[model samples]
Target: MKKHLTFLILLILTAATGYGQSATSDADSKIVTFRFQPGKDMFVLKGNETELTRLYSLVDEYHGRITAGELPIRVDGYCASRATEKANLHTAYLRANRVKSELITQKGLKEGDFVTANYATAYNGDKDVVVVTLRIPVKKETAVVKEEPKTETRTETKPEPQPTVKEQPAAPVTEPVTETVPETPAPVRPYHFAVRTNVLYDAMLLPTLGVEWRINTDLGVKLDGSLAWWGGEHGKTMKVWLLNPEVRWYLLHDKRFYAGVSGSYGEYNIYKYMVGNILSKDTGYQGSLWSAGLTVGYQLYLSRSFSVDFNLGLGYVRSEYDSFGMTNGVRVYKDRDKTKNFWGPTQVGINLIWTIGGHK
Candidate 1:
């Protein structure tokens, strides 16, 4: 009976230890979002000494749990909305990667045991912040134990010299205990398509249209076109057509800064301009210009779907022109065909953009 009591006590203690560990793990699994400096990559922990301490402690505990249980952990990284979508996505990945690096290098965590994901601005709405979370897999098992019932054997003095009948075999012990662990839910998908428009074209008085296809978080392509036509008395007329296409690359995590290469073809005819600053009465120049250049730009996002883009392009322009003499808007003669070349600013624009087809 004493042995049974001791065994019961040991079992109770073991169960209590397991429960305590489970509770500790739960406490350490909180979702933590850390702040960073605006437009910078450094974490901001000032006045958060307690939180910082707790964060490190939680990481250590997580590492210990995984090591002890040999269980896998999933660590998800997230960043809040920033100046650009690309920056947000990249920043989130970097933040999560940084944490993973620390755990592996400082806490002796195995890299393969962790799954890291970047949720970009989808998880957090705050600016310049990063969130990290840990998840453990659930497992179920069963254990069977047989407990012998306490028996007080009484000695019979009746010299029953007959072969002592062996005590009836103890009833077959059969007990099954089952334990099940809760399962973790799967993560949400993060990738999507987005379309954007540049409003600056409308303000130019020359109606323009643009389409942008964002290939991913770091790269995108845009195609734009602008057109204008005007006519007045004395054979004066002006017409312009421009087609511009560019490919952009986001260089920073916040995606506020970008560089692009653009190619443009422009055709114009200005019968309104004559020699010596006079209004054209019969002569004008018709020309086509082709330019290829590089541009650097910046974007400031006002909201999840709205932003302003500023771009400037500098490159070489090759222009070919022919002089046409017109009489009352009728071409009568042509002369002075020539070609001119120069290297300078080719484009300047400020655009208000609306992003569509992407998650808010």
Candidate 2:
């Protein structure tokens, strides 16, 4: 019985020692945590003493020691459980890369200092947090500045008048005023939603608005709506409304270039065509138009919040209209239900897009 009790006591002691060592190690370092919003890669750092801010302060304080030798930094990223495992994993990867980018580009830390892991699937804690564990303590240096310098500065007297030994101070020994240039911030990645307007329609007095929703990394849907309802001088009437919906696939690695399949429907009444900003003739047509097309476009991200797109489409177009002509300032309908079919140039647009939500 005594032998068994002794073994149990030794086992307890060993367990306790192991836990104590872990506690001490954890106590020696601080674990800072930064949180992300849903579908965002950037962390929140606005509040007082936020984890991200604290991490920056810590890095700033220990920068000298960090650059002198190897500084171990571990960044673990996570996402919420709302998305699929693959989506969560992708978000986690972006979050970790974002932190590493800011640390290297903004804070002047070296990339080799980072040890990164994405734990969106494995993490069970706060789903929106990225935990940063720095292996060094805040007090990387023990010598306090006040302990050795204030009294010595007080004891030193002003310099006595000295004779000039040379005619000029040599340029080599007296270093030039070398200003440290700041590093440029990394470009923001586009994501989520966007609003756009087509200039081609606007020139014809038809105001248009388009909305795009990014469903995933590569696929998206866009809808464009246009309206022009106005009466002109000399009985020239222009009234139309159009809706175009498209599904797009971003094939390029930059996510700027895309291909889309589009369908359109419109109702229009044109007494005179609005071409070259002029109403041309007295002949008019009232029509319902339908089109199905394949569009190919390339997008250029001009800024974080804006992009320019150029696209052209070719497909089948069918229009059913009633031909009419004005007689002595009176309407005269000559024929009805005249149908026309065209197989080319269904869509053309130069769109200016504004991105919404946070950059992904």
Candidate 3:
């Protein structure tokens, strides 16, 4: 009876030990995790539901391999969106199968591999779905080698003396060569700016007006105009005016001062009042005249599109018509002639400009 009792106790103890070992081993195992989302149709590793299923199978297979000890069990898993189609039953089964296959083909899993799967519901607007999670096992092993102790031995032997000779001068040493590096050149910047002007004049003795425009930084357009009037005693009156459309080109564009040429055509008009000489006190004369001219100007910029312009240039002004008459009803006749030469300085003025277009 005593022997039987002892034997029974030993068997129980052995079983308990085995159980503890198995439990502890599984508990200490390591695992790898995989995540996936849904894509259009194909199994996409990045954003695809189909790919998620495939990942599940791979994990399952890995778990099997670890359990069977065919490969060191490395923990692995897959996380899928809960919103996937067939959220519950379909997703669960699909994940299990996929995980199993993955372990076998990709990770070389075998039977008895351990795998744990979790399923959850997800709502993706259009549908309610299931997400699957998997965990796989992994194991690590290390080996160390011990080296044998070495013994020390001592032996005495006569020293051999080398023959000595007179010292000779060592050969001259050569200096190391060095390469020279070349310097890089600086980049060149381009000059950019433009100016233009247009003008119109009347054939009758009237003021001339001109419009000026500047294209800044070689990238914009500006417009402005001017007029001038002239008068003298004795009915001798003259009026010159300019109409100009101008573009400015800044040679040295410093934002403030711009040097450019202005071109314009203008009309000049004159009225003359004549007084009779001492001998012919009975009569006086009056007449009308017309002509045209061109000019150029330099501009100093004040703001982004505003400038003060100083203009001085020459242009051809032709007289179109002329008339002469006396206040006493007496008339003097002169052909309606044109003057070919009419040139002079243009007036100084400030220009307010606006730029349009070319804002990137």
**Judged by TM-score, which candidate is best?**
2
lDDT of 2 by residue, 213-312 (tens): 9887678899999998888766678889999999999875456788889989999888875741353365788889999999999986555577798998
lDDT of 1 by residue, 80-128 (tens): 6567778877887766665555445334455675767766555545665
Ranking 2 against 3 by TM-score, winner: 2
Error of 3 at 212 (Å): 5.1
TM-score for all models, in order of appearance: 0.48, 0.49, 0.28
| Model 3: how far residue 341 lies from native, Å | 1.4
What is the C-alpha lDDT profile of model 3 across 1-360, one tens digit per residue?
A: 999999999999999999998777653333333433432211224444455556444444444343445544332223244455445435444544444443343333443554444444323432222233333333444343434444344444747544444444455555686854322222111112223232222223232333333333432233344354655555444455545444444343223334344454445444441112321343322332332334344555333333345554444333354445444343464544533345554333433333322210
Which is the winner by TM-score between candidate 1 and candidate 2? 2
- Best to worst by TM-score, what's the order? 2, 1, 3
True-structure lDDT of candidate 3: 0.40
